[model samples]
Target: MATIFTRIINREIPGHIIAEDDRFIAILDINPLVMGHTLVIPKEEVDYIFDLDEKTLGDLMLFAQKVGLAVEQAVPCLRIGISVIGLEVPHTHVHLIPMNSMGDINFSRPKMNPSGDELSAMAEKIRSFL
Candidate 1:
C-alpha cells in the first residue's frame, strides 16, 4: 500500500506543497509544530531513513537544505531545526522546523491545529522564497 506521503506526492490527497523536484517533495505539516513546519520526503517511500541508499540519502538532505533555506526566509525564526523521528508514519521523512527557542521543535509538545486555508497560505509564502 502507498504511504500517506506517497499519496501526497502523487496528489491522491490534499497537501500544502511548498516545493518539489523529480526525487523529493516538501510540504507543510498539517499538525504543525510551528507556522512554517515542513516535511521533506523521498518519493520512493522507504520505510526507514537509514535504509535509504547512500546517494538517495545525500540527495534527500540536499533537497531538505533547499527547502530549509526557503523556510528560514519566509518564516521568522532563528534557525531551521531538522528531525528524523519516523515513528508516526511508515515512510522516511525529515522534519524542517523553524525554531527561535529550544522548545520550538519539541515533538512531545502539542501540535498546532491550523486550518487548511492557513496551511495553504503558509505554503504559498514558503514557495515564494524558492
Candidate 2:
C-alpha cells in the first residue's frame, strides 16, 4: 500500500504542497505545531530515515534545508527548528517547524487545527519565498 505521503506525491489525495523537485516534496502539516510547520520527504517511500541510502539521506537534508529557509522567511519565527520523529507515519520525513520558543517544537503539545483555507494561504505564502 502506498503511504499517505506517496499518495500526495502521486496526486491521489490533497496536500498543501509548498515545493517539490524530481526527488523530494515539501508540504504543510495539516495538524501543525505552528502556522508554517512543513514536512520534507523524499518521493521514494522509505520507512525509516536512517534506512535511506547515503546519497538519498544527504540529498534529503539539503532539500529540507531549502524548505526550512523558505519557511523561516514566509513565517514569523526566531528560527526554523528541524525534527525527525518518524513514528507517527511510516514514511521518512523531517519536520521544519517555525519556532518562537522551546515549546513551539514540543510534539506532546496539542496541535493547531488550521482550516483548509488557512493552510492554503500559508502554503502560498511559503511558495512565494521558494
- Model 2 agreement with the true structure over 76-95: per-residue lDDT tens digits: 89999999999988999999
Whole-model Cα lDDT per candidate?
0.96, 0.96
RMSD of 2: 0.6
TM-score of 2: 0.98
Least well predicted 10-residue stretch by lDDT in candidate 2: 63-72
lDDT score, candidate 2: 0.96
What local lDDT does model 1 show for residue 16?
A: 93
For model 2, what is the alpha-carbon lDDT of residue 65?
92
Each prediction's TM-score versus the true structure: 0.98, 0.98
Give candidate 2 misplaced runs (Cα > 4 Å).
none
